[model samples]
Target chain A: MLLSPSRLRGLGSRVPPCSSFRPFTAAAAAAASPTSKPQVYLSRSRNPYLNLSVEHHLLQTTPPDSTVLFLYTNRPCVVIGRNQNPWLEVNLPLLSSLTARTKPGDHEPAPTTIDLVRRRSGGGTVFHDPGNVNYSVICPPESFDRDKHAEMVVRALRGLGVPGARVNARHDIVVDVDVDVDVSESDGNHGANTFKISGSAYKLTRLRSLHHGTCLLSSPNLGSIGPLLRSPAEPFIKARGVESVRSPVRNVGVGNGEFEDAVVAEFAKMYGDPDVFCEVGDEAGAVDGVEKGMKELLSRDWIYGQTPLFSFSTYPTEDDPRERPSLPSDFHLSFEARHGQLSKFTFVNASSAGHVDIPSSSSSSPLDGSRIYDVEDWTDALRSYGGTVNSQAETAGRWLNGLFGTGHAKTQLR
Target chain B: MASIARCVRAARPSVLSTISKPIAATSRPVFYRPTQRCFSATPISEVRKYTKDHEWIDLHADNKTAVIGISEYAAEALGDVVYVELPEEGATVAQGDSIGAVESVKSASDINAPVSLRIVQSNVELEEKPAKINRVPEDDAAGGGWLARVEVDEQGLKEFEGLLDLEAYKEFTATLHE
Candidate 1:
């Protein structure tokens, strides 16, 4: 049975009626009728949260054997894997600094913030901005083919001028930067050859599967996005989410008009009639699931707490105020975080209050004549003379967590 | 709910024949505590049915419990099992609902419930070593490939009406290659 509009649109009241969006759904009644084309809900929503909700709704509501395409672009957001930790995936400090300056140099009405969204599919975190476009293919699990879905984008891009566009073994659509397409050789000096244009991820159910990905177009400055994609500031994460490898990326067109048209055409040829395709909401929160997805994606719990359990160890360097001149520079803080919550916090000071002469830290530095109790290892470092490690762990946990405690999912990139 | 004794009775030879192994063809001594034979072990011993989605349920002697897992064909197709998200304990799931998921090669496949029942226990060993499913999916021994144990009874067997028998499932998967 197909979902009733009310059942699907129970979350509708939260979204305003879209002037562009038609109220049609793949209801059982519609499925009961004949002579209609395979419906494509081409949403106008730019909100990533809403766009993804539409994708999920499409995946769940559509019949197992039916095929449909969903297309949209989101504002700047860093979406991660369902099983990944946000702390490890996003560069928090860098995301906080993006100026929401539009192309004409006017700031958007809303303050610009990098969003953190965990996708149901398993893949590395990705960056999305208004300049990028996303497409998802929902079909029966038996009919779903990974390469076939990715090939649509490759063909669409090639038709729009990227001749060298090809899906790599990693399922990324890449263009060799060094080898010019002779069309749009990059004008930047990023010192990278292969620029990924599209990255794909998939989620499967008993009857159906959905494959979705993004195309980097002219809006996002690929060079600028590189900083936010870097590893976290503290490197305290060790979770099992697929890590996003830093690859050189490129935007195909300066504008999305040609590319979007090509996509709509290719999907129609491959799946149904192009003329049948109709546009949906062109604004954020103009459809269902946006309100629910936003609440979860915007929450500290889902973004940070969903991170896989990890352990981190930090040690103080030479500038610690609690350091004694004759003491070794080994003050370590061992910590463990589960679902992004600190589970174990410990502080160890493996220094003996003795003046025994020890070698300097590394080959570069010369040791003063004083005794050095430098802790070289946490497992087998110098024996603690008279300090408590548990108390130190608690003290350090409070201090470090206070500085980097829970905050909004919106973070700094720079 | 008061129970007399809990024992793992081995699946009968007819059910074991579904596995493509030499031992399956032979009359292997199916181990069982001779004491529990007083209950209705006949229903489960007769055969194991498979869902179209490739899950199988092996009901026990009492007919109130079942061990469910993906078929060997599914394990083979999924490549190496990296993670298995088993259903939570005591979660009452209806027939046809997804109980959990199995992630392999970065793609996750939902594991569905064949019968409406509450989850009794999940294979905790799969949490650390999911590859065990991939290694010996056809094996009936402990920690081979079973995903969960659920509360099922004579009425639960009614849910298996539309499911395929071992031979039928094999035939269905054969058409997949075509």
Candidate 2:
């Protein structure tokens, strides 16, 4: 349905998109219309998968030209880009350890299950918690701009007295914090005072464009984020997809309710008051396609199989030459993986009498065709290669196990 | 050359300029050649055809295969493409299926199949240097930003016929801006 500027004049009062609308609808089963109105939905579901599914449903079912605003906050989770390599981007071992922590701590035991999600968007990885409010804007393809809504968020932050908040060159919202120049410079890397408060990513289908961002507001896990996002294999792996640009982040010092309300007001300023404003919960799963989308998001295939092709090398190679960290054994190991399956592999034990390279074709090693996610022990995976299982090999395996998040059960989804 | 599709330039530049233009833009035709040509084959249109979604397909001389890529306007609108997730070769996709996806300006946009076809080859160069897409998004040559080469079937030919020609696509985009 094509809408001229003139036709959008009076339709503001009653935008016509949702097939059925109640004050607090259980599901989001809206249909597209010629004369569509702007819609706003605030999610009560803390499940990242469910919230993402509802967002996807809205992106698919909304009118091609209508604008939408969806606000949701998920429990502790590390969300990666659609095409990113999770092993390279996230510290899976750290995630597993935190998820396994059952002991009661000063603060509740570190989130029992921190979900590892691969979102259907493109960008670097981000850490999301209940303290972080996620806002999504979906509009027509022609009207899509990466920074347009991010700027609106900056306005919202400023409205909430974050006067230093502004959209940075990378489209992330950052705040300029004043620091003692003498003391900060003593730390050797204190030139920039800006701390990112929000990070943005986008997904564009044929008909609609969706931009979503994470606004950090009083997250207790801020200190833990650095370790959780840093991977042990970062130095040894060369990946093909997007890599996260590290930035110092801080909270906007506002409540989630205040941020959400300010953002909604800013959104209303841009597209007029929303025709459909309501809060949706897990009941959104009852929508026509939300269940299927949630299932896909939760599947191992989508989480691991969607990774771009990448290569891992223990020693320095010409393609990715750098000073190598000393390994326990003088082992030369390298492999190429596409879609998380080992396609080619080479393992050599230089410590043995005259280093012998184990060609993957001749060796019946279990690592071949093995999904990286399923490997529970790198030592066992390497022990079956018919070589002397020396302490050096065991040590190398233990290091690899830590790097690859092996030797522990995969974290269960919450 | 007539089979090569082209699109109008998008008026607005994308928000992010992080994607630097590729230093070299080379036309290296890297596609599988079909030897057999049927004389009684239906005469497929020689001109390029476009989907409303901003994808374009150019039928090969054999009329059984075509090359697909996003339009120039789409490339400009997408800003600098950082990566392209190429579809697996030898995979058959129905019409409207996502053939691949392109990432630019932190946005992942699907490049849908213009018609039902079996992909035979993909542009691997774009995987290494994605900026080539911003430089030559419509170039079907080997090093060009063309996404894939697919063998079309009878139904694909019918679907192709329904796509908009270059002129109609121009008018359609104009209306969108209006």
Candidate 3:
């Protein structure tokens, strides 16, 4: 059954063609009756996968002429891209083991599920917390324009009296923190462009495509994000997945209590008719599809098993000479993986340079500051440590006596 | 290797599980071939034909099978290929339908079927080392850098005729880039 904009409040059980909405062009948009802008859905579910499923559902089922905007939130989690490696993108060990305490020091109510998930789009990874609001735009392939949506976001933020909200060359919405310097004049380092207010990604099917991004209305402070992003446990991990560029991010609605509603109102005014909004779960049958999509997204196979083939290696040297001169400089751990599965795993104290290469593990270390863990045995630890790419790194940490130093660290999968 | 096929199957369970028309046609592991090595047995029998989307399908004398891959212009345009999402061996595709995608530093482009055919073998080497697509000589791309082998009978051969010859496709891509 075809869905007219009027029927959006309810739906037939059957899914429609990819281009099931009204045939729309800019001229047709102007001449069209009533639904002038886009269809808006506000998702109440905080489950990260569920919210993503809702966006994919709309993208998969929506008509070409129709434009859709999904504004939702997720409980804290790290989301990977479709073609990314979780081992390199996130600190997998911290994500799997962290316990979100319901009461102080009580591990029983550990509700924290800070795991990695792969999104069906091409871009870098992103972080989501309850304080962050995500916006996704699904349009016809011809109608998809990331710049327009970026402009709309900046325009909406400006309407909320937020200052210095503008899109940079990378198409990220950055709020200039420095009062003295313009963003363009600053160095290209993402860290210098503090307070990345919005991050976006895009995907295309044969018929329609969608562009989705995160908006920081208010969020747990930026430092809380570093843990989910990467791990300090491993000194460094090298992989070739699409790595997320890191920039200091800030909450747009931090001081203003009304900022969430204000930003929503602004987006509704710009992208939708305030009257034509749909509360995602309000429809009865749609929840099943969202639930299915949610289950699909939450699967371990989808999350970890989809990562591109990569090799990750870490060198453990003197972390800080002033603190611990006892630690030696030549210890290294390396692993090769395809789809997050390990192929070659090795750990060695190479006194000789370039002795430890995968499928050939040959290296011997002096008894100086480093105690020998025997290069031959750690391979078993890494293979057993494997569920996600991040887990393997954690196994290396455990077997070698946490040489890299534990605790959460975050980095992109570049 | 079956491992790569297993990985692809796991990654795209929904699509592969649902499509019942094509039998699993992927070449099981014969042995590890170097990414740079050209298959000496399957040389191009006929001149190359190009799809508007930049894929070149070389149908040797036996019109029943053809080797297909992206064009030199496409390889040049795609920049460095970080990943290539290949189709399952048994999957059957209609002309112009997307079988898989090729991801580069720029963006991911859908790999379309130039004509209706059954996938017989996927280049597992590309899955292991995607840059090989860029490494193969551009002039010999249709022979050296092919992405997959597809089954083409008389009907598939008729469909191949509608595609542009090498010179026409080069001219076509020129107009697009300009």
Candidate 4:
């Protein structure tokens, strides 16, 4: 929703005594020191929701040391990472349907609306709604600690009785669920599977302001997440249903009223700081900055700015010279480095099947209609042809190596 | 309520006394005297010594070898560091010269050497994990996760006097916040 600061202020004035919540006590405020208590601004629309633009404005124009708390409600939206390709991260068809259904020129969408926005962080995609509350903690670089900030969120959740809400190494908070299974076991249940409840990512700017991700207590349509992210390498996998990388769990909305009330109370207490207050003038500047950022994000050029250029040649195999059904044969690969790191990798092959013949022994099988052979058998056949084995493997081996190599390459550059 | 009021009244005198003591003690403005001040050399403690262009140095004992990492304040302003490039070990760098580059998620930054020195080691850990510079920059003191360590020349030491001290850096940062 277009929850500009002025609109919020106007709504605040109209709200009744029910809007008045307890301010944080001095002792609680002191305990939350060093990490300045983010100003708690209760958004006052009937919808009580904010958009990426408004949050971005707050980040851009707020004082370097100030932290902001955005309390939103009853809004649904999809936000993408700053460096991510939205086309790769979002379901185009689903988004089109949502947009078509949404009324034009509406500042706030009706209940069950979807707003698509982009964030200035490097990470995956996320879905937000009123069922979910997003919190952005913007402060000076020295004031924020990645792990500590994450823990604080977890603490807030726990205060609402969602105990054992531990953050994963990747910063995702997960809950374990038990589902009916068709197993031979007597209990007819499998091991506990983890379902991701929240996902977080962070960005630190030269301005010393830090912005990160927080998706709280919402049961997003998990089935939608897969279709949104398109992977060129696995089009077939896309055709099949996309499996969630993390497990599934119940959302916080399933909790009782006391649970919800406790959460809001804890957040009010946790993010409280009497030393700071809203600066009305800065909010206007923040809105301008956010508008500019939204424009840039919406631009197709910035969304799909850089493409990995690949160069490869193909050779034909006798079995499938006309058309290779699966794997292409006789291929050579080359990767080009950009910004001092490998930016693109190209594969060239000439096989009758139009696919490369990977040894059965290798983790990956030949895509063409070649006979399956184990690793030793494939090596023996290659050796017979005077082919020398190299460390690079087209299948699982290369994939694993790339994981470490890519990480190493990025680290060295940093 | 009475106890709280009494506590506030008792603490008020101490707070006022502490505030007034500083102004009262410095009344004798001894501007000409060369006072042996602990930080007379440089006011910014964490900045190490710096070059004229604002590159700071962190020197080890014996004055010959030291690890180098950017100041905490420098990293903050650079924002969302995505990549960091450093000079290779055994490479030589001079004071105020660009030794490497640090690319943020937004832009690229040059890592300038504060003093002329030869690179004895480079933090190879950064090759796979550049965020280390942002996450744990202070840990570079023990030669772990440092950007680079270099041997400085005597001339470089003379240039160190031009850099800011801890106190000066605090003032500098305070201005940025304002």
Predicted structure with the largest DockQ when compared to the true one: 2
- In candidate 2, the second chain superimposes onto the true chain B with a TM-score of 0.77
lDDT of 3 by residue, A142-210 (tens): 444556677777876876777789988777898877644543322333446466888877665555666
Model 2 chain B: weakest 10-residue lDDT segment is B1-10
**DockQ rank order:** 2, 1, 3, 4
Q: Which runs of model 4 end up more than 4 angstroms from their true locations?
A: A1-38, A42-50, A72-78, A85-117, A177-191, A206-211, A230-250, A254-264, A271-286, A306-414, B1-178
Assess the local accuracy of residue B68 in candidate 1 as a C-alpha lDDT between 0 and 100: 82
Runs with alpha carbons beyond 4 Å of true place in candidate 3: A1-37, A99-112, A179-193, A233-236, A254-276, A282-292, A313-333, A346-397, A400-414, B1-56, B71-82, B88-98, B104-109, B120-146, B153-178
**lDDT (Cα, tens digit) per residue for candidate 2, span B1-178:** 0001111124453312211232122343334435755433543434678887878898866679788887776776667788898878999999888778888768788888888999999989888888988888778876788888889999998898899887787666555444
User: Sort by lDDT, best first: what order?
Assistant: 2, 1, 3, 4
Model 1 C-alpha lDDT per residue in residues A158-230, reported as the tens digit of each score:
8777887899987778876555343233335356667788888778786667788888876434545666666
lDDT of 4 by residue, A268-294 (tens): 455552243321222322344544765
- Across all candidates, the chain A TM-score values are 0.72, 0.86, 0.67, 0.53
Kindly indicate the candidate among 3 and 4 with the higher DockQ: 3
Second chain TM-score, each model: 0.75, 0.77, 0.69, 0.65
Displacement of the residue A173 alpha carbon in candidate 4, Å: 2.5
Q: Could you tell me the lDDT of residue A21 within candidate 2?
A: 35
TM-score, candidate number 1: 0.75
